[model samples]
Target: MESPLEPLLDGRTKGFPAAAGLLRLGQVGSMGWNVLAEDLPLPLAVLKETALRHNSAWMRAFQDLTGVALAPHGKTSMSPQLFRRQLDDGAWGITVATVQQLRVCRAYGVTRVLMANQLVGRQAITYVLDELARNPTFVFYALADSVAAVDALAAAAAVRRPGRSLDLLVECGVNGGRAGCRSLAAALAVARRIKAAEPYLRLAGVEGYEGSVPGPTPDQQERRIAEFVGFVGEVAECCADEGLFGADPVILSAGGSAYFDMVTSLPRQLGPRATQVVIRSGCYLTHDSDAYARAAVRMRERTPAIASLGEGLRDALEVWSYVQSTPEAGLAILTMGKRDVSHDLHLPYARVALRPGRDARPRQLPPDCEVTALNDQHAYLRTTEGADLAVGDMIGCAISHPCTTFDKWRFLPIVDDDYDVVDAVATYF
Candidate 1:
């Protein structure tokens, strides 16, 4: 049977025979090809295949250099396809923020998971126990902050099969961040409680987040992060001294995208027999040319090891909005709004402008062309020199924060080197 695109190659459509033939041969789908090169109004988010592959390899190399395993947080893309790629690249496991995210990873056949956050509440504890019982080989780790949290897991684990312990990590918290044991005494107390509830829960090791530690300078940030990494090392030593891990390998997980170098230096404090040091940096998968690019630059100045990460991770994510109204002499209102690209971190980068079927070319707007504000369906762009911009012209905006940008879209397309769509990647979140 002939496919729908086969008709385009039968000399029916003029001037699109090559596209039609490629589509019929299953080299490219009709929808993807048409949307990418033809400038169709598809309302889609496109991921460049070459960039995606580059980012993956770059992360793996970073992990190799740092001596810390990369278990990229799965909450960013939430795409099973991306998760499968990370797993194939020898990722220890995937990290998620919540139990619902665990279900998402599970649906993708991901067995090993690190619930980076805590598993609080009765239902969440039950979910964790059920996940453990169902997948016997599945290793799950969650942050334990208090006695109540440890007791809840202990009670839940008791109801499950005997001899099975819920692998748990004590989260060390700074005064500002979300969940974690505040001090060494507090952390040791939490670990003691877990050990007291023994046979049901095992104190894996220590886990902490350095990303949330804010500072006025890079040195300050690094110092603060190193302090947490030091805390992780101290806990690792304490756990081993207390013989908490027993036969199983003790796990020490830390590092978010900003400052993994500090966490890489943690083994010195953890001593031998620490076994595993997992770094759960999520945004490394889709490194943004804006936020992370500057971050990488700053990190290079301080560390220099992270500067040689990789190439081809361009800001491929863009919001293709049409010029809806050319109100003033130099002002153009776009069809995109706050709902498109994220405005929390930084503003978007203007990539290029396009007209229907015309090759996309970089157009320099006035030095003052800035997106001042965005409504739900319109973007107010201010321009200098009163330059004229016609309505219906499409404006491509390069995004800053990929994490927030990804959550805004469910289905995103995958494009080739020449901005031609090869496939489409979709996210559950």
Candidate 2:
């Protein structure tokens, strides 16, 4: 099926200057705007059409092999078009961070949403309950790590009396983690509280994010992820035995982008609770070229089944910037910087380069080419010997974390393998 380009969200958009006009959604790229050909403005983010479809299919295959449903974390892209694609391809639901993001998914007609984060504040809580009351088909669930949070949700639900029960997953956390209960016992206690909340709140199941587990070495990291993921299942079993888990098809979700493979094998151990294990690894949609690439390698190493798929996730996302100046030998300043791409996990990788009116195919960057520094609007590209780089050359950078990189763009053009802009998607950050 042909992908539909979302209509121009608004004329006054940033990054892509040509978007400011009365343009047809499916025909914006009719003139064949090529990233390498310099058709769009500089510092533009683009997704490779082939790679995106391949990544989505790869994830679905993983789900099929494991018998686990997918509620891909929507916070990674926050594009309703992507969410729709994920669902249409067999995702269980969309996972979002805040109520505001949930609203965006709802606006796009998503019936089921998993609020991976705890719903805090009266306003956010009120909004969720009101929506559930208004929409009969809406299936929403959130995390509760502490009794205080469960109490807040229960009180808010009681006040709203949406005639609907709020589903909650008892979040188990690793020590030194950001959210969730640090121990299995603590998580179970919160589950009991959720059950006690009665009609206001229902103990849906157990959820945790294994990405926060601390491991000094890769081996240690795998061990820790396994341990935490195991605990989540054990807690689910305990909750079921204790009658705390009242929601059927109990949720046993615990898969971040890095260690999802470890989390996917949890259903067999979760006992016969009629549970559904959800892998919420959102970054798999736009696999990174650096950090997550390394993680995927690790996944293939520890699990031979994944490596058997030949090439796993490909680099689907890239940002284009021009070489503004060659300040010194082996050093070039690029027009793209932190404001355009992600530098939090690691600096963007110098993947490919295109010289306008010269290179037809994008050439891979030199082995020693690296982006060492990034200012607000400039990237310092440092290359070693045998590096042939010139001014006015377009540098295509592969990012590390799709989560942070996406917030920098309001709109991203979906491009084909030949760098032709075929469709576009709006970002709701």
Candidate 3:
């Protein structure tokens, strides 16, 4: 069978370069100009259909293999369309990192949530309590580390004790990372504080993040991640020993995209406990060609059952830019700037140079075409070979990390196999 993409071009140009020709004709006693559509908003990105489905299936399969319910972090891709697909795939819930993110998820019909971060401030507390009241069955779990955080949640919910109670998880931390109780003793102390202030807040489970911890080597990294997961298990047992949670299930949630393999195996260390393990990996959605690509390879070697997640998750996001100038013989200036794709992790990868309005497939550029530098609105690309790309040629760049790229566009158009726009996805932040 022929791939849908081939015929959709329909003799049209396979790749876009510079505008080919312009025609002027007079009709109905009027003179008008016809020019090829060469220019588009530069550095545009898209989510490829192939990669999207691959990531979705990979995460679900990972959950099935590990026996851990997936509550994939929603902060990675704020697209509600992605969230709906996850729910359909048997995800227990979606995990978010902020009050605003929860609002966006709730608005989009995500029934269960894990704030995954500390829910602070009266405004944030009020928003969470109100969400619980509005949707009685809607479950939300926030991180509680310090007494201040637990107190604020309890104080806010105290007003509506007759309504829903705030579900919470004690966040475990190692010395230098972000928010979490450093010691198991400290976590228990915080849980005690929450119990002391009942009816307002309830200790539901234990959660931690492994993304922040650094590993000296692959072996060292694995050891640290395993220890972190083990600590989360200990907290779960503590809650069980103390008989804190009544009818509700105790959550032993922790795992980011990079170290989920280590976290999911935590149950082996806990031994015969009935606690539910929830892996909150979000970046599995739009796996990058750079940072996440390397991590996925490692995960494949370690966990074979869910190895499909690492299979051909294309760098679907592309930045389309025009060559503005050829400077100093070896350099070309692009119309895209820093206001476009993220440069914090790394620069964008140049995929192809589309000729203007012409229909021939794009020939691969020489190895010298490098994304050398970026400014506010222009990207400096250095090239030594490949058909002297003149001014006005379109270049499609593959991105690295997707979290930063998503916020650049308010609305993203989804194209089908034929490259024809099919649907539009909106983002909250």
RMSD to the hidden true structure, all candidates: 5.7, 2.7, 8.2
| Global Cα lDDT for candidate 3 | 0.72
Compose the digit string of candidate 1's lDDT tens values, residues 219-275: 887788888888877877887788766466778888887776667777633445746
Which candidate should be chosen as best, given lDDT against the real structure?
2
- What is the per-residue lDDT of model 3 for residues 329-368, given as tens digits with 9 covering 90 to 100? 8888988878777787889877677676673555567766
Pick the winner on lDDT between candidates 1 and 3: 1
Residue-by-residue lDDT tens digits, candidate 2, 1-429 = 222335454455655655546554555557577777777788889988999999988987888777888999999988888898899998999999998899889888899999999999988999999999999999999999999999998888888998979999998888887798888789888999998998999998889999988889889887988888888888888888898877478888888888888987676544566888888989999999889999988888888888555669998889999999998998999999889999989999988888888999888888779999999999999987655779999999999999889999878889998988888777788
- The candidate scoring highest on TM-score is 2
lDDT for 375 (candidate 3): 92
Candidate 2 lDDT score relative to the true structure: 0.86
TM-score of each: 0.88, 0.94, 0.86
Q: Considering summed lDDT, which 10 consecutive residues are worst modelled in model 1?
A: 4-13
* Candidate 3: worst-modelled 10 consecutive residues by lDDT: 25-34
